[model samples]
Target: MKLRTCPRLQPLKESIRFLTRKPAQFSDGSRICKRTFAGHTTAQQACDALVYNRHGHYDDVLQLEKVLLPPVGDEDLRIKMLAAPVNPADINMLQGTYAILPPFPAVGGNEGLGEVLEVGSKVCDAKPGDWVIPVDAGFGTWRMEVVCKATDVIPVAKDIPLLSAATLGVNPCTAYRMLKDFGNLKPGDTVIQNGANSAVGQAVIQIAAGMGLSTINIIRDRPNLKELKDKLKSLGASLVITEEALQKPEVTNLFKDIRRPKLALNCVGGHSAGNLLAHMEYGSTMVTYGGMAKKPVPVPAKALIFKDINVCGFWMTQWKRNNMHDLSEIKAMVAELAEMVRRGQLSVPTCTQVPFPDYKVALDATTRAYSSKHVLMME
Candidate 1:
């Protein structure tokens, strides 16, 4: 039987022949074909396309390359990433030192704000066009899109800026868990924390204040200590003092008039932790989250034995996975904090937003900025 080809089929055959002979034409024509095809078809029918990737580390630069989009599974949700913060953990991931190590040629970014472009058949809670924040750590949030388990993505407030939502997974959650779970904080109680100028620390201050708990913040000596102290105090800190002042004998009497703090949050280990512990009352608990100095915390035997001081550690990822109650509390706290930010009651501090175009410069700035304060990277 002889098959007759239509006039439209003739041109398609010619174009295919031309593309077969000169593959470069195929590359050039693919975009036009893709656009036309996309206009005619729905997203579910289209194949996954290339996005972004980091191949390896060359000097300080993350060797980024464009690659094919990842295939989504039945339980996965495909997200179009809008913003991801360049947090300290992201830098650590690049250095191959972070606790969570993603596979090589992997994307790096822990927290990101994204829109669900598509979800597999089994994905019930997520839907296309829903703005969501990734709940999992080190899920390659740096890329323009990602495929993750639907359970790993959580819906976020639409009114919140994508930048703010991008940072929702880590610091704020850490602060919430540390304050509520480890501290067992009650209304009208007081909490003390070193690294009080950190993002987590600042969140703790705001959350504690909003929860009717006062804060005693300890920060390093900065040129603008007075201004920093005043700013922290404005954020519901009952008192703000330098680490040097914490070592002074007068610290005991300092909180005599104020509510004695039952909980102390320590991010800075070593001698700094000892100073924070000294300020805590008998039977008070101190939770160490991060060791920024990379030094071990030295708890005085007297405080542990005689004063009944409890020294504990908090890792937000592990805590969230292990304790459902703690996770629920964290979600509630984030909602409360988001409301506060909306109401202009909680401030995120002055952050320098770096555009994606200037990411390298911003990364360097973030490294240096860590010396003084937390540097928030906005993508």
Candidate 2:
């Protein structure tokens, strides 16, 4: 038998030849650095990051420092960060209050979006100009740039708003997984959640609505309670009630047109978490992902034994670690959410941009009662 050459394979061969060659200059005749990527790849000479050597409050622990970029190798990609969110988890980790702690003298951010500046030999999955997110936590995303294995970053759509892409990896992914892995939720099915105004909660409201599910949002009663309810309701909530209202006899009447919730999402543990478990349907599960109240979950064992009400906890960091090798599921979920964002059906949390030089202001904001989501943008 004679081997035959295929005509259609020529373009791929040519493209590979082009990418592998070392280009010294562009059409404009500008010299390229020997260390820089030979083609579309580019990068800065140095990087800056927020890191802490001691475990303490953000006010005392975090410090900004400039550092040299690590050398890139055959399996690495250079990433230039665009924006990263300062989440409750990041703050908890900073204070040593979180379940997973990084080694001492670690960087401060867990999630963000970045631009691929360059890829080393043997790297084909990601390339220059592609927008990507970190695949694991403790990536030290608070840094201005990174040089890591190509698999360390996952590509996302560059067209989505920067804020959406920057904040997508943690909150939205957590909401998607919890809403999916816990129960067999269906259209018009009721779902109750406390901390409904939280980033994940807001995500649940929109994603659930997109799936035809109804939500009863529980928020702390504030002076501007009605306004907050209106805002959340506009985001696809079926009903919004204050924490005080959760215990009211009339609250049940709101479910007249809907069935009692089979699932409850909890982020505010303590009395708030107990209220969620108390009001959910028998045999339902309450998933707790956060404890903003800084108190223990008050679960009544009587209900657990008789009503069969179960309580559980979730940490996006742990979930990522457990499923790090197989991220195809997360990629699919992200694409789905991206479509919602593209269609304007999903909205990012209200972010207050804090430039890198004003880091102190942003760090302090994380400890306050402010409603804005603090975002650190590279200078």
Candidate 3:
């Protein structure tokens, strides 16, 4: 048998040797460096980053520092951050309230999109100009640039909307997993969720809609309630009701058009969660992923004894930890979600883009407006 060889194969092995060769050094051992791809110099670089020296109020502790980054090494990629979101979790992390906290003096963001400006030797999976996102949390993405091991990030298609790619790592993944994991869900199956206007909730609505499932979205009553309801409905929500409406007797009348929800996603907790449980079908599951209300979930005795409602909690960080060894499923989910974005099935939530240096404004906006999503753009 004869082995066929492709004529298009580049001399990668030789290039690897050249790329990975040690930097030249003088007699005294000081190194000589050269500028390479995308104007990256083979020397230590200084970049501006948002660092928190100690866990406390973000306003008090978070500082903008000129941090020195080491040169890219073999199997590493130098990423120029494009954008990162001012997620609630990032705030919580800075305040020492989140479940996972990085070491002191850590950078702020865990999710963002970056452009790989330079790749080190042996970095076959990613190359200059490819867009990438942190594969898991604690990536410290709130920086101008980063030198990270290729394994720490995953390449994503550059064709997706910039904001969509920037915010893709967490919220949409959470929504996608909860919808698929909790329910033996099928097209036309009904799912209900609280926090309907939340980033995750909006993602749930869109992903469920794409999967042919219907959503009974419940949000807290707001001043612009009508506008909010219309917005959710436009995102493919089968029904949009207020949390107060969930308690009203007339709410049941809406169920006449669709079956009771088989799955419930609880983000607000407390009364809002109770409302979701009250509307769930018998033997249905409710997955709690957030406690924005900072209140305990109340479960009625009848719900457990009569309805057999199964309650569980989902933490995206924990899920990633459990599946870190084999990320095929995670990768597949990301691919599907990206395709959805390309097809217009998934859209970036309402966002206020603030320049990276104006992170304070973005943080303040995020803390003040629960419904608004703020992103920090490097440019």
TM-score winner among the candidates? 3
Q: Tens-digit lDDT track for model 1 on 243-297?
A: 8988888777877777778999999898999888877878999998888878999
Counting clashing residue pairs in each candidate, in order, gives: 0, 0, 0
lDDT of every model, 2 decimals = 0.65, 0.76, 0.79
TM-score ranking of the models: 3, 2, 1
TM-score of each: 0.79, 0.86, 0.87
- Candidate 3 lDDT (Cα, whole model)? 0.79
Model 2 ranges with Cα > 4 A deviation: 1-43
By summed lDDT, the worst window of 10 consecutive residues in model 1 runs over 6-15
Candidate 3 wrongly placed segments (more than 4 Å): 1-44
RMSD of 3: 9.5
Candidate 1: clashing pairs of residues? none
